[model samples]
Target: MAALLAARAFLEIRYLAGDARRVSEDRSPEDDLERIRFLADVCHNMPGIAQPRPWRPSRRGAPGSSVQQAMAKRPMGWAWHTAGPEKRAWMLRHIENAGLQWTPPPPLPARRKGPSPMTLRQRAGVLLGRWPVRPPAGHLSLPPEAHVLKALDSDAICALYEEAGRLRLGLGKGGPWLRAHLDADSVHYLVPDPASYYWPGMPSTRGEIDWWQCTALLRMCDGEQVSGMVAVLPETFAALPSTLPRRKQVRLVHHARTTERDTYLWGRDHKAECDPQLCGFVPETTGDPPPDD
Candidate 1:
């Protein structure tokens, strides 16, 4: 029984060795040529690296086989022999431009000192006698009666306002404009002229607001002239040590104080939003208006 077990173990070891040898032999000459070409290209691109010599097949080993014939015709040198199977496989994938030849990257241009050149649009505006209007600096001050429901971190606020009807405060020199639900479906906006409440430093095209940089300013009175609304931070409802309790009673106002003029002029030029729901489709209309406004 001991002899029989030893024989079985020997046979298993021989079988594994045979399998490994077969796998090695199965690699085609084309594969070796590809590897050799890739390595040659890499060596050529990198300075001071020695190029691999071509592979020459042994006449004693499978002399008439296609692989041997191919190797005889074009020998791929000894460079690939040192690379393990895993390394060879990785090299195959990362060979630049199919191992044709290595092209060195162009050198970067010299940097110019001082202010950058004006854009074509800016130049054109000047040529047309239109002076560029600069936006005001600082945060847009809220109305005297505006109430802060809660204070929270930026991430929490962005998540909370991720939904369709969230409001955004655009700070400008003229004053802050309360844009109604960010992605609501109202045909008409509360503020008709968008330029009047220009957001400072915002790109000409629509840009996103960082929730951390903004404070939620809600109007709490409903005296016909006053708009009653509430802005709450998401962190206020989260499970954190510094989180504040979520506010109640105050309604989420979806009324926009300004409409995008370009939307009307250009027939609704679609702007991509981080949240897909905020883009293209109008948000479902819900939430009651605050009483007394």
Candidate 2:
């Protein structure tokens, strides 16, 4: 029974050291030494095991006799080997907390190739608004061109023309109202018709020339609001020379027929309003434009 218990303990030690080979029945002192050396090697090589620092003597000096003092200076594994079961168990717990374990962690699963075809389809559907198209609550109609001009004074009209010409020269968007300071006293303004979609340098949309002619007359009264109207046709608006003067500025405004202020107010009040569906029709320039007052 004594031999059996010793063999069991030896096997347990061997297992901790990760040695699978069977132990010899007639093991010698040399064999025991070799087993201890193997366990020391295993503990040192374990990933999370901390390196043991040299034990220091107390301020009072060595704790015991010269023989005991020498033992204290020996390697940590030497103490571990001589420790009782309770001390050994405590050391094993510390080892576990340090992440030193017998078994390795499992490998991670492989990643997928790419987004599936169905996912791509769903994304396309969302972008095109084909999946769920909601109609707008109220349609914003443009007032007649006469009404829009009546709201502005002659100075405002000139400022609009100068600024619109400047924007046309630079091919950029003017904030709020299109404005240009032509010297201190000279400024021009023009009501940009938000219904026109200007795609400069591209082929003019079907009936664009006729639509502009009618709209220009309606907005500026054939150059009555400021100076002569300059129609920036697709090619002209896009590739016109930067040196072109205010005389060459177009009287057209491009976008949905709604002012920035009106759009902001509408969005603020009707938070859930759906975006209006864009119909390819050019708006009529004959009727009274939407009321600005």
Candidate 3:
């Protein structure tokens, strides 16, 4: 009975780990649920094997000490501990091998593409209803080091920023708003932090330090939920010379668009109260800081 139980546990672990590998490689949330369901089913079938449980690492230190610790810490794979220590170690090795297999291939070198041009009217239409999505256009083409910024019509950027005001939610520290609205230029783009995503020139150029980059930063920052003090912030498009002129400094006012404000209020009573100025940080600008409002 013990031998059969051990064998069943091993099979269950392999199946669950395989599911986890698929989810990790594909990054499909649906796959994650499927993995969970499979694990639950395994626990149901293998009555002698301990039921799946959450992994809880020891607070003292030395994470991944035991199967219990590892399972507790992981978002998935809690069923590996059903067997003895030797079996658990074997299961872990298999899981590790699976991880190596799923390791993402190096990103294909970026080939610049498209004109990505839009008139002010078109930009407005994007902002009001749909996301501004156009491949590089005009001189822009795949291969050359060129990029374009398309503006979304809705105040999605502003809304994301305001909601993140109270909570610090992100893969890491508080980051720049991935979505941004410019009262000065009346433009929007996706601006993510240079550090968050893997890129060639992350520290130097902030991983695509352009208009779209800034917009994504605002959007990312806006959605981040912070439990403790925010350690880092994503780069700002508002401070970028490409987006904002050097001689001019723009005040990042809390946007007055009631619809977006109400939509993404960070548990604030009044959306108007949610508006706060951007942090005081200088960009990689050549000249002195722009005049503050």
Candidate 1 deviation (Cα RMSD): 27.1
**What clash count goes with each model?**
9, 18, 51
Candidate 1 segments whose C-alpha is farther than 4 A from its true place: 1-98, 119-121, 127-293
Per-residue lDDT of model 1, residues 81-146, tens digit only: 344565444444444324434222232222221123444654454355432222233435322222
Candidate with maximal TM-score: 3
Better of 1 and 2 by lDDT: 2
- Write down the TM-score of every candidate: 0.16, 0.15, 0.18
Scored by Cα lDDT, where does model 3 land? 0.31
What lDDT score is found at residue 197 in candidate 2?
34
Q: Model 2, range 1-293, lDDT digits (tens) per residue?
A: 11222344455566544433334345555666676664454343232223444544321111232333443443343344555575456456555655665332122222221111233543454344331111122322222221122123434434433444464432222222222111223323333232223312223544322212111212221121221232322332223223322222221221111112221222233323322232111223222112221
Tell me the spans in candidate 3 whose CA falls farther than 4 Å from its real position: 1-156, 159-215, 219-293
Candidate 3 residue lDDT tens string, 59-142: 111122223333334323434433446544544555465554322223222212211234465445434542222232222211
Query: Worst lDDT window (10 residues) for model 1?
Result: 251-260
Compared to the true structure, candidate 2 yields what TM-score?
A: 0.15
